[model samples]
Target: MTYKNEQLSEEKVFKDPVHRYVHVRDRVIWDLIATPEFQRLRRIKQLGTTNLTFHGAEHSRFNHSLGVYEIVRRIINMFEDRPHWNKEERLLSLCAALLHDLGHGPFSHSFEKVFKLDHEQFTQRIIVGDTTINQILEKVSPGFSQKVADVIGKTYKDKLVVSLISSQIDADRMDYLIRDAYFTGVSYGHFDMERIMRVMRPIDDQVVIKSTGMHAVEDYIMSRYQMYWQVYFHPVTRSAEVILTKILHRAKELFEDGNYTFKLEPVHFISFFNGDVKLDEYLKLDESIVQYYFQLWQDEDDEILRDLSERFINRRLFKYVEFNPNLQMKEWMKLYKLFQYAGIDPEYYLVVDSSSDLPYDFYRPGEEGERLPIHLLMPDGSLKELSRHSDIVEAISGKKRTDHKLYFPKDRIEELEDKQLVKQIKQILYGQGEVENVR
Candidate 1:
């Protein structure tokens, strides 16, 4: 048998906490899992700094990727022989779902922001570059690796297949919601995924839910909204992320400084600091390596790098107060000046972080990050947008909410011998009446 069509003698099953079991049969799938690039995902946490906030959230992207593949597998089985579903596309869909998150690096979002890297771009490169994943995909077809990249990148010819992995209510989101909820020990991500999958119909170019399953989809949407605010954007987790980002920033800055000398070489970060990271260099970076660098930097001579690394490794997260950058320009300048006067580098110490989400949105042409809206298949066999059918979904549809906070090391501020300067900073952070109450 050819490699793509070959089957294992027995089904390999992975005991999954979220999906219970992830079954593998196709030799191609099995080989892909064993590849070094795929194995790298085990070292990258699914939630990044979220584990610091929710102690139970130590699950890795390896777990989430398997959950996504299993979900698509189940959906494909249900789609067998169904109208508008071509069985020829089954393997491609499964491959796409499995490899969707293959490119995320250590502390994904923070690393991306500081280095200006897109994990999706890296994912495509890995699939098409001279990697084990690329070799495995090429065994299936001459340009099969590119096909997988296009599917994950949302540039594939089959919109229906793409919808299964990249849609507003696709397998990727469905698996992560339930999986993250389970790992984080939260109820917000809970939703009846089975009902939604069962009622999903393959239309010409999209997957639409049967109107009978509208309530289930509604629950899914609300669950995503709640998960974003309550769990994904939890204040404590953001504080940890703030410290992590600052650590990266400090390390990169130090790397660029010719005068600075490190006790230990930052070999892993050289490419990232120079902004020309190659694929091999990127694949070598994972959570453990980043953590090791942080541990070493804790003893570095650069005080800011040492302090930020210490804060990250020891969980000395910055305290935050609600900040409106637009309305508080003068107060912000004064705060910056005050920190500098007290020997604190406001560049790293005072950070304004913002988080925002639009729970659900209808497509608006030419808008940035436009997403296809969910559709419901009515009993009359006509398609209607989800917001038109459910009041619960409509209420949050297209409404964007944002949060802004100024994060700083308040403990350091308190340690200042100049008590009067501390009071002034506190008054700026907290109003006059609230200043005395602060510890």
Candidate 2:
């Protein structure tokens, strides 16, 4: 038997809260899972700063990665005897699904934004570079490692495999939606995944749902919409993200100034501060390491660094007000100046954050990041794009929605020595009357 086809004497199963049991029968898949690089995902969060809002969202990327692998495994099993299904691609698909998120750093989104790094590129490196994962993939075949990386990058020639991992409704999204919802303890992520998966059929280069499963598909789309607004884009989560971003900014600035002294030197951050991080340095970072720095920086002499570190470590997130830069530029400037006058650094303390989503979209041939439209296979073998038949999906198809909020420290604003300035800020934020108790 080929290395890729080698199965264990007995199947191993991992009990998962979302998928019940994640089974591993292939020796290659099991070996990859045991690698140190793959194990590192246990230290990184699946949802950055979201746990601050939904306390139950403390699950790590390891959990979600395993869930994704299991979903792909089930999909491949169903496709085993079907026409146009390539059994040769089975191991490749499973390895790609399991290792897709291997390179995610601690608080992935915020870290990427602040450091100008791409986790996807790191993932490619871990797969193709000289690493344990690469070693195992090489055992399968000299070229197998590159194939798995190409699959995750969406550059693989097998359009069918690419669609399985990345299309509008694929294993990655399907797993994360349910897993995130389950861990976050929210009702929005629940949907008939089994029904949808059962109806999935591979036709041409894409996976299509049978016409009978249209309602389940509709429910899945609606569930995604609710989760985006309710859980993924929660205001409190954004507040924590804002503070986290500011903390990184302040630390980088202080490091470049060449005069500030850190109680614990950010050995892991120097390469990042210089804008060229080595893979080894990057791999050494996780949420625990980041928090360790935050804990020590709380005693730093720089007040901004110390204060921001304390806020993040202790969960003292910023308070936000609804403010649109397009409509409230003058008001935003007024607040910016007022904050500076009040001894709070406007650049660090005042922030505006925005979140946007395109609920669903049909294929736009030449568009960048174009999503392959979800199609339904009719009894007569005719295919129809989803939005054409589903009213709820049609209402949101191709529509982009965005929301913005202005964040500031409520404690600092309330304790200002100048009451008139505080009153003006409050009036602008909460109308022309006394500041009501708002949570």
Candidate 3:
């Protein structure tokens, strides 16, 4: 049997809370899942620091990857007998969905920011480079590895296949919304996914929802909207992320300084500190390894490193005040110096984190990463862009919203010897002398 057509005598099933049962029939997919690189995903958290907020969000990328693969599997199965859907692209789409998140490291956002790395680029490297995933794909066909990479990269010749995994409403988003919601124990990500999938139709290199499924599509869009603000961009979660990012920055700074010494040498981070991380070195990092370094750094002589590590390890996150940097530069600068005078290291303790979303967007020809707008296959045998028919989607379409918060250790501020300094900081933050009891 050819590698693409190779099937297990009995389908292997992974019992998933989100999808119920993820069935694996293709030998290549089953073998790929067994690879050490893919197995490493089990160690990486799906929601990163979100578990700190939503306690139940301890699910890993291994869970999410499998969910995504199952989603695409069902999607392709529905498309199998439809016109304009290439039967040959079935394996390619499934493979891309399964391995799309393979390159994500532990605490992905913070690590990528401090180290100047891109997980998507790493994903492509894993698929096309000398990795086990590449070998598996190459075993299927000589050029299949590159083809998988292209799909993840969104540069594949088949836009239909690319849309299945990378587009705004693709399998990746569909799976994560429900999976993350399930693990986070939130109601915001729930939608009629089965109904939406049933109405999915491929036309002219893109997938469209039938007009009859428009309500289901709206619910999915609204669910995404609520999930973004309620869970994905929760302020408390961002606080933890801020501390995590500062911890990484402090470690790198201490490593660069000639005077400081670490209790445990950060062998895994040396290349990252030097800004020349190789793929092998990158692959070696996971949350456990990072936590190990954080634990050791908590005992280090560097005060900043020690304190930040203690905070992150113990869930002592910074409190935040809403502030727009673009409009409040002068206030931000004043707060910066006040933090220094108050004996707080502004660099590590004070941070501005921003989260933005273009909840639904139609194609803007010249824009980078322009989404192919969701289309509704009307009963009249015509296609209509999503916003044109759905009033709720139209209101949010093409609109971008951003929220920025200035994070600081409120506990340290409260302990200041000079109550006057604390009062002034409160005045700047609250616009009045009174500080609200809100954390």
Candidate whose lDDT is highest:
1
Assess candidate 1 and give its TM-score to the true structure.
Answer: 0.98
Clashing pairs in 2: none
Clashes of each: 0, 0, 0
Q: Is candidate 1 or candidate 2 better by lDDT?
A: 1
lDDT (CA) per prediction: 0.92, 0.91, 0.91
Error of 2 at 219 (Å): 0.5
Segments of candidate 1 deviating more than 4 angstroms: 433-439
All candidates' TM-scores? 0.98, 0.97, 0.97
Candidate 2: residue 261 Cα off by (Å): 2.0
Worst 10 residues of 3 by lDDT: 430-439
Predicted candidate 3: what Cα RMSD to the true structure?
2.6
For each candidate in turn, give its C-alpha RMSD to the true structure in angstroms.
Answer: 2.3, 2.8, 2.6
Q: Candidate 2: where are CA atoms >4 Å away?
A: 433-439
Please estimate how well model 2 matches the true structure, expressed as its whole-model Cα lDDT.
Answer: 0.91
Q: Across residues 1-439, which tens digit of lDDT does each residue of candidate 3 receive?
A: 8878999999999999988999999999999999988999999999999999999999999999999999999999999999999999999998999999989989987778888888989999888888898899999989999999999988899999999988879889999999999988889999999999999999989999999999999999999999999999999999999999999998888889867778778999999999998888888899999999998888888888899999999999999999999998878788888889888999998899999998999989988877789999999989999999999999999999899999999999999998888888889877784433312
